[model samples]
Target: MSHSGILTLLTDFGLSDPYVGVMKGIIAQVNRSLTVIDLTHHIPPQNIHLARFALMTAIPYFPARTVHVAVVDPGVGSDRRPVAVALGSDPNAPMGFLVGPDNGLFSGVLSQYPALEAVELTESQYWWTATPSSTFHGRDIFAPVGAHLASGVPLQKLGTTIAVDSLVMLHSLTPQRTKHTLTGCIQAVDHFGNLVTNIPASEVNGQTWYAVVKDVTVLGRKTYSDSAPGELLAFVGSHSWVEIAVNQGNAQSVLNLGIGDAVQVILNQPHSSQGD
Candidate 1:
């Protein structure tokens, strides 16, 4: 393996352990000059859907040819295939490579770059350890193959090619829409405790709507700052999705919300005002 562009790491293995460090060590052994950036290691432990969203939101910021290794495999030892994906509309020019389990972790990335090619990381020639562990493929299989890909190895050379359509899709993460309402699940709760919903901001289009989260209703605000301090409000978040938040406070703490909680955004009913 030779020197290459950025190698990113996204995992549920928090910094409290040596799992992340060991993976990087393997990458370093393969290509000492490869710059490894920690995209994030705090993925909430085996939460594949959250990992999918995080990857989707963050990948566009990196330069082309970046190799991303994301490991949030709760089914690590199972029949779930270890895989590598190359994102590109053109078969000849790959945007980048992603190495991880074949679970929904890569679904968002695949959705954005529909032309991407994928393959099961079956070839031991690309992995770090000959006898890979059942539980820790992140350190053994994913890390080294990502390093090899960063070093300019062809996608096909890694293993047998699989269609992107065949990858495990995170279909449930999408919001359900009706004539008067858009229903979605809480994809994640950020550090600030804002509930990030799968409902895109376009669905509401900044219209007057009321958000029902955890059975509590709050009128939509343009921004968190628009609402009174400690008052719960729903707004278009940074990623262009509707989020449940509290101005100057934590919604997750105040409202007892968690990931996968249901959220609904419905068109606000007009009141019969005297002027109207």
Candidate 2:
């Protein structure tokens, strides 16, 4: 079969390096007609969780059969295995592909879809050049392999089949819930300074609540304008997660909150009216 799906790239190798570019070059060399999109090239160094979250958010936006290649391997030079995964719960949908280290970066994606197919990438000579480098497999190995796969190569030809249980999984953000209270932690801080938390919108519906962070209670608002510009407000975010943001300011800096900080949603009525 001829290759016809989109190939997407995600990595912590910032644009300053020739790493990402070289990978693309290798892919183009294998299949010139393949379309490539750069999801991001600025993930924090070795921040696998951030990479996983970024991948999950971008995958749904692409058309079916989109091949996603991610490389955030801190253990690149180590004994870790490179992998290619096809994600989909329904057997009929065009399966999504992931080419990267066998680290826990695929955790979030696998969590949302349990029946994903996984395989270890073992084809060596078929890589970009005759000899591959230990430190930069993204260019030598993953890129070429992904391009070839996108070009209609059967996944089984890449390597031997493996059970999903054998793959690595990262620990995702967990939200704790009580009678009416929900507690979660900040998972990441985006470029716009918004603190993305683990609390989902389903946890706070039909209830009045306060987002308590570092002892400061941020009032829940229906929208950003419900508060003065640059003032902090808590609202249900685009991903169905409750977010702490400022209309035109950076909530991460303004509130001095960082990842793993404790955030609580107290569902009880505001304290001021309790005595009335």
Can you give the TM-score per candidate against the true fold? Answer: 0.91, 0.91
Residue 208 accuracy (lDDT) in model 2: 85
Q: After superposition, how far is residue 144 of candidate 1 from its true place, in Å?
A: 0.6
Name model 2 segments beyond 4 Å from true. Answer: 1-4, 90-94, 271-276
Global lDDT of each model? Answer: 0.84, 0.81
Tens-digit per-residue lDDT, 1-276, candidate 2: 433468999999999978888888889899888999999999999988788878877777877677888999899878898888877775455457888888988776777766367778777755776577878889988899899888887777888788978889876558888986788998777888888888888888777887888777788888887899877788888866788988899999888887778898888666332211
Q: Model 1, range 68-101, lDDT digits (tens) per residue?
A: 9999999999999899988888676677788999
Q: How high a TM-score does candidate 1 get?
A: 0.91
> lDDT (0-100) at residue 181 of candidate 2?
77
